[model samples]
Target: MSQDKTILVVGTYDTKDDELNYMSNCIRGQGGQVLSMDVSVLGDPTAPTDYSKHVVAEEGGSSIEAAIDSGDENTAMQIMAHGASMLALRLYREGKIDGVVVLGGTMGTDLALDVCQALPLGVPKYVVSTVSFSQLLPPERLAADIQMILWAGGLYGLNSVCKSSLSQAAGAVLGAARAVEKPKGDRPLIGMTSFGKTILRYMITLKPALEERGFEVAVFHATGMGGRAFESLAAEGSFACAMDFATQEVGNHIFGGLSAGADRLTNAGATATPQIVAPACYDLVDLVGWKPVPEQMGDKPAHDHNRLLKAVVLSASERRDVALAHAEKLSGAKGPTTFIMPKGGCNEWDRPGADLHDAAGLAAFVSAIEDAMPDNVDYVPLDCHINDAQFCETVLSIFDGWLENGVVKA
Candidate 1:
């Protein structure tokens, strides 16, 4: 009974009133405040909510009558989703809500995603859903920091099993709200992308170096979900600069591999954020290791990084296609961009006589990048491999120049 935080309880209160109220009581029991938002389109809650369905629908730019007249459940829910998300954002901005806990099945979960995404990163977003970890939830649909607990056995009515999930979710959201230390924007932030240190070692050196120079460095893994989070921050204009070094997600998007969506490398450019780019692992596409290799990739050399991931080395032609894709994405940059081409090799595994080395493939990729280099991007071709000391120094040199020229503010 020590915490004093407000938690937003969102759901189709018309049907799930009892369950929602149970969660609200749990929060109150923990010394937390509750604000209820009803998103039901057809029925009313037994008691009036702080924000009624009519208020939610109107906030989304439509009326309840228009939603009923539409006669389409999907359309009606979309209207509610838009309204609820906007209202949730407004509540957060006004400092009225500290965290959000949303309850639903598939339809409710769909609306929950929108509402969670409307809030900024670091605001606690918890979802209690029947399809909590199901494939129905794609990486792109999720907010960067969303948490979900499976709504077990609570679909029809509240049971002991489901009560466990609801109570835990209630405590977790309230606890997170009390303990969270949100970004203070104290230092200029740099968003960088790379794999683990075994494959991409630039972050090991660059992070401390950037910190010494008064910049906060956040390095994101280039896997599907990691890249999605990086792009989300970039789109928010959260980073002063983007060091997008590990761009394997671009090749992954091209070759039916694990992807960060079609917009993997374009967010910073779209927001006019200065970006320094390198294709650290441009020669491979990552696929889930347990899945059967696609017939087209069956003949390619593969590396099992772990039980979770497998990397397929692209052929020379495929490497060229990826290089051109990078160029195409960079060509539309609205701000300053620099693409560094490491002529020796792009990744450690592709270096001289390494297990994954393919000199011809590297040559093709380098040539494609040079030939397709856009006018706006300053293309610098270096003699060292991407993991070499010289490559890291070059990056620092460019960043230092930017700082001096006021392109990157400290």
Candidate 2:
């Protein structure tokens, strides 16, 4: 392993020997030292196994080949994934590697993502898979399981695409190595979640407000990847606080909505960075269009923006469950936190008279907060709705509290 370098070629030599070897050569040829570590599931390895998936497999309960010998690729894949994550995380802890580059076929991408997710944020990571382009592989499982782990943008397994993606990924890793020498300042990063509705509000108002108060905020657009990316950074210790102002996606997660589950919903908040987490827009579910709106929701309350992408008012039962769950999740925050309720409504169309507004649901939402909230946190109700300027200001004020007192010892 090259301690002096950054890019590390990580893959299973059992299958991707040729591709990984090529990746290693390209990385070194471009002025980046490459360390080839085997995440091989085939027992002993020829390449340096910095943190073997075999070890993780052994430790995490199952071996891949053992599972395969029983004629179960599905089981083997599951075991391999769990083991890969453990192996990558071990390497990350020891600091023997910096960046990771992987090459594989269908099984390769699946196994590769397992390793990617385990490594921390900002590390250069790449995966070149032959099965990447095919619809044969389940995109949702692949996405939910592996996307966050790739330190670099991913490449499809197609030959042409791999060639393009690998070259860029290799060069990017080298650049990351060259750039790491410049130490960053001490200002803590803050994670912010918003949507198109609030993006403008944040840009014109909140963004400057946060920066002026000394917080370096990273905003996520409440979309699946965007939300997941923020949580990923948070788990990697990237943010000191968060303003989860747009949580409408919870309904999207529960429904089969096209958005995303955006894993680790409560992760950053629970880490305790003086989180000002709220039920922001927990009152409604995002629908691609009004056509899919369930029969119970009635012809789109008044703010049905367009026939295609309409916001459906959540049911009284759905609102109660989600609000209860949201409050329960927000309570997981490890740092000082607050949950604010705006008396009027949550989003643009959620005010007192909007068609999408479900005052019954709103009351149930706050009631759940009051009844189910964890004792470790504080729950405060405001005299405004989500779109109200006061609610925005209060959210910022809580972050300010963290900016003053949220340095956890390293």
Candidate 3:
């Protein structure tokens, strides 16, 4: 018989015992084993739990009895969330669970986020919550690969709609656990960051060249969540090397625009990952046309990339500051690092006479990076745009050298 996949079903069993039981039965029906973890702080769970509320609360540094005595729902839930996350992570590490599925309304979803974030990528985490993908929970706060489904008609009781949603969630997680191939340890994994495909065409050449050379390249979108995932994966030593070409998130993060949280652009250096850093899209910051523009971008070149997505051009002064910020982060790298400057342009939009083109701004950014770059970092200035064929060749050649010199391994 094939090994049965175990899915950890986490929720407030005291409140949603029937719902949890239904989901557990669904998972069992799908030929998967279920490990129920109850995070309820009040009342007893109708179903038997492998990890009871008392066990969960204790992991969170409090006991369920203490939480009940305190009489603060928020505090008790907070404690339960932490404890549940700890227990869930422990179970995953011990190979007791192959996937996790959690269901709830607001409180359950909040706790689910903790559990999801506690697990690493490729663990098949799913959350069936009423507040599915709500803006209140920013992308940076959750795990990069969490799959959330709207819990339609799932509030207050068991019903046909709730059962359908729960059943689908169970099947989805089980299928994922069965089909998802775990990462192979054969080829070295290379993490690369880029914006839109059209905007960052170098990846087309960059990716194939690296793959041909026997390295697996993973490209991450330069959005807030994508950046956070890249950073998180880097911190976990998931990459043999990284080519961080898209840095618009840094501008947004430093300027309080739509940022990738406070941790953008700091991971590879901290983790000693050999990285090639570029200011590919650092000249722009993300903003929505519906929101009021920042005073710092007053009268500057702004491109309405789309109705809701606007790119504000940074001035020469702002670009200089961003370069300095890049320096501050890159200078502390414990591994071999290179900072490349593409002098012709940073992005497709930054080409001469393009919407984001500004000669003075580019000059200021390059100059600041050059002046501030530490001796440990190799600073290379190429007289070509970032997406140029020559620039791609230059980067690949450097990677080849790194590979041969043992700076990066295949």
Best candidate according to TM-score: 1
lDDT of 3: 0.87
Q: Find the candidate with the highest lDDT and give its number.
A: 1
Candidate 1: where are CA atoms >4 Å away? none
- TM-score, cand. 2: 0.74
TM-score of 3: 0.91
lDDT of 2 by residue, 1-410 (tens): 34356566766666556556666777778766765656555544555544455665675577656756866676776676676667666665777666676666667677776677676665656666655545444323333223222222333222654556567666666666666543154665667887776312543467778777676767786655566666666665567666776676766677544344445357676555656666666766666574656765555453455665666667677877877677667666777767777767777666666546677878877777778878877777888776668877887676555556544221
Write down the lDDT of every candidate, Cα atoms only.
Answer: 0.94, 0.63, 0.87
Model 1 TM-score (2 dp): 0.98
Off by over 4 Å in 2: 1-5, 42-96, 130-169, 175-185, 197-204, 258-264, 287-311, 352-355, 358-361, 396-410
Q: What are the models' TM-scores?
A: 0.98, 0.74, 0.91
Choose 1 or 2, whichever is better by TM-score: 1
Q: Is candidate 1 or candidate 2 better by lDDT?
A: 1
User: Could you arrange the candidates by TM-score from highest to lowest?
Assistant: 1, 3, 2
Candidates by lDDT, descending order? 1, 3, 2
Runs off by more than 4 Å, candidate 3: 1-3, 60-62, 65-75, 288-299
Collision count of model 1: 0
Which candidate would rank higher by TM-score, 2 or 3? Answer: 3
